[model samples]
Target: MKVFFVTLGCKVNQYESEAMQKLFEASGYVRADEISEADVVVVNTCTVTAVSSQKSRQMIRRAAGANQNSIVAVVGCYAQSEPEVVAAIDGVDVVVGTKDRTRIVELVEAAISMRNEELGIRNEQPLSVVGTVDEIRDFEELPHAPQRTRAFLKIEDGCNNFCAYCIIPYVRGRVRSRSLESIRDECLKLKAAGFKEIVLTGIHVGTYGRDLRCQVSGVSGQKISLVDAVKTVLDAANPLRLRLGSLEPVELTDELIELIKTDERICNHVHLPLQSGSDEILKAMHRPYTTKNFAELTARLVDEIPEISIGTDLIVGFPGETDENFAETLEFIQSQPFAKIHVFPYSARAGTVAATLPNQIPSSTKKIRTNSALEISRDKSKIFVERLIGRTVEIIAETSTDGLVDGLTKNYVRVYLPDENIPLGEVVKVRVEKIFHDGVWGDYVD
Candidate 1:
């Protein structure tokens, strides 16, 4: 069987798609180059935001249109939350939620077996089930990276954070992590596969290893924190660098920060989420970290790792955000000046705590705040890139554009090098020429 997989949203979704791809490949399936030629198209959907959910719907219709006779299976968080809405689409034959990745594979087979004329079109079958989706054990299998450049090892699943704004914990269930052995084995395999980097991904990475503690000794066993996980991968010394996914601000500790300084292989970039810089607004949104604590930690990290690229996620116009609070947030961001900012206007989902909160900001206000934050982010990013000018740095070459190849530095800055001689997965040194709007332009030094 030939199959195409479309993934949206978080790195965790991408990791799960890799897992699904492995399942099909193990079942003797060949990956399709395009949706039109595939026997099945499995869309690993994301619903982190309203925009991502809409994008998922767009991909489903696009996939269905491309292959009218092919089996269309939609799975992942968006499907888990609104399977009914996805099922209503014209061409989706199977809609699986967060729980049934294995079942989704079976459904794809069933869908392929059905005749095109017999397939339902007008209305989608209902699949709006909640809570844990997997009835059986999680497959212990580790999925290798689809590309040779990088690998995503999902150490944990689900979230217990219950932030008033996020729909993930509700859709994906409470936190569940893979066993220490399983995580190590996958990292080792990816390193053996010639991958240059392995990103440890999850819904909530900070809360990793808590669930698996009961499985072994140490009585509240230090089964391994995310830091320990990174250390394990580093110990393997497969010549692969370690990069972490988006992390909650509260997760940054002395040990984790120290690891970044001590481990030469760990990337010098950390995505710390500061949803709001106003404590009152944070309380209204039910985020655990206070503005004061977040700011102090931010300063502390910068103090320790002077060259670290600190990126962050910020929400504008959250519920009950007063004028003073918004100003305070703007002031806070200006003071910190993050390397990258993921700015989002608040979208109230159905069952989230902040959805029903009073004093929601107007759309116009949200737009204004978003623009302001973006402008600052762009400036900060440019400054960081500019600082690298004339400095020779090592980077992982990934793609080429306009006769120049581009790759990311250890700090995760994309740099363009004037060389076709560089292979796709090899790390090479390049001297910075100039910083572009998107990335740095440079010449290959060695």
Candidate 2:
């Protein structure tokens, strides 16, 4: 059988899609290049925002339209939150939630067989239901080795931080961490598989071991932290580079900062989301930290790791945010030494508390604020890249196309070099020559 996958959302989703692909491949199923030719289709959906959910629905319909005979499966956050909505769609044969993804191959096969058997009897069969995310307890670790040059290893799943504007915790359920032994084993396997870089991903990676016995093991031997998990991976796998995903500000302890500072393998890059830089707006959004706290943390990180690339997420036009609040946010972001900023226009989903909040900014105002934020982000990014000129950094060659080999530096700079017969996945040192577009033009060094 042949399968086509449509993956949406964050890196965690991408990792899960790859894992599912590996599972199908192991069962003698080949991957179809397009939905039109596939025997089965899997749509790994995202519900981060209403837009994401809409796209998920569109992709599901498109997949079904492309191949009416195919067994269409819709899974992930969208399915977890609204399985009934997905099942109501015409061509979805199976609806699997955030949980039970490991058994997707079996479910898809069974779905195909069941649908075929019942096709002659009736054309209005209900879709098969897998498990719901609410009952999810253990972290479902994917047992497949990653195939890419840079592997995203999900060490944790779900989130307990129910921010007012987020539907993630509702759809993803509670925090569940993978065991230390499992992490070590996976790290070893990925390293053995020749992946040079490993990016640790999760719904909320900062609270990695909060639910486990190692949550408070500093003075004792009982608790484990995200720092401990990183150390374990580094010690066991010793990958050339280790990168972390988005981290909560509250979780960035002095010890964690120190570990990143001293550890040579850990990339000197951090993506800390500062949703709304104004304290008033932050409170309205139910974000625990204040603008002052965020500023101090960024200052401390810059002071400790001078060359570190700091990135952030910003939400413009959030509820209760006035013109003054937006101005304060701009001022606060300008003061920080951020290398890149992911600016998002406030998107109020149906179930989020912020959706019902007063003083919701209009779409035009949101766009204006978003544009201004993007301008500031571009300036900051330019400054960061300019600072890299004449400096040599290590990069993993990701792809080569059109006589140019493109790769990302340790500090997350997208560097491009002229095609030099450089092998993909091989780490090479490049000296930055000039800033090109959002990245830099670099020449390979021996």
Using TM-score as the measure, which candidate wins?
A: 2
TM-score, one value per model: 0.93, 0.95
> What would the per-residue lDDT of candidate 1 be over residues 325-398, giving only the tens digit for each residue?
98998888888848888899998887899898888789999999899889888888888789999889998888
lDDT of every predicted structure (CA atoms): 0.80, 0.88
Q: Candidate 2's error at 172, in angstroms? A: 0.5
Q: In model 2, where is the ten-residue run with the lowest total lDDT?
A: 120-129
Clashes of each: 3, 3
Which residue pairs does candidate 1 place in steric collision? 87-124, 99-133, 99-134
lDDT of 2 by residue, 1-446 (tens): 89899999999899899999988899999999888999889999999988899999999889878977888888899988888888888888888888888888888887777777886331355455655566677898776656578989999999987788999988888999988888998888887888889999999999998878743335445777898899988988898899988998988988899989998889999999999879988988888899889988998998998589999999998987899999999999998999999999999988889999888899999999999999999999999999889999789999889999888888899999998899999998898999996799999999
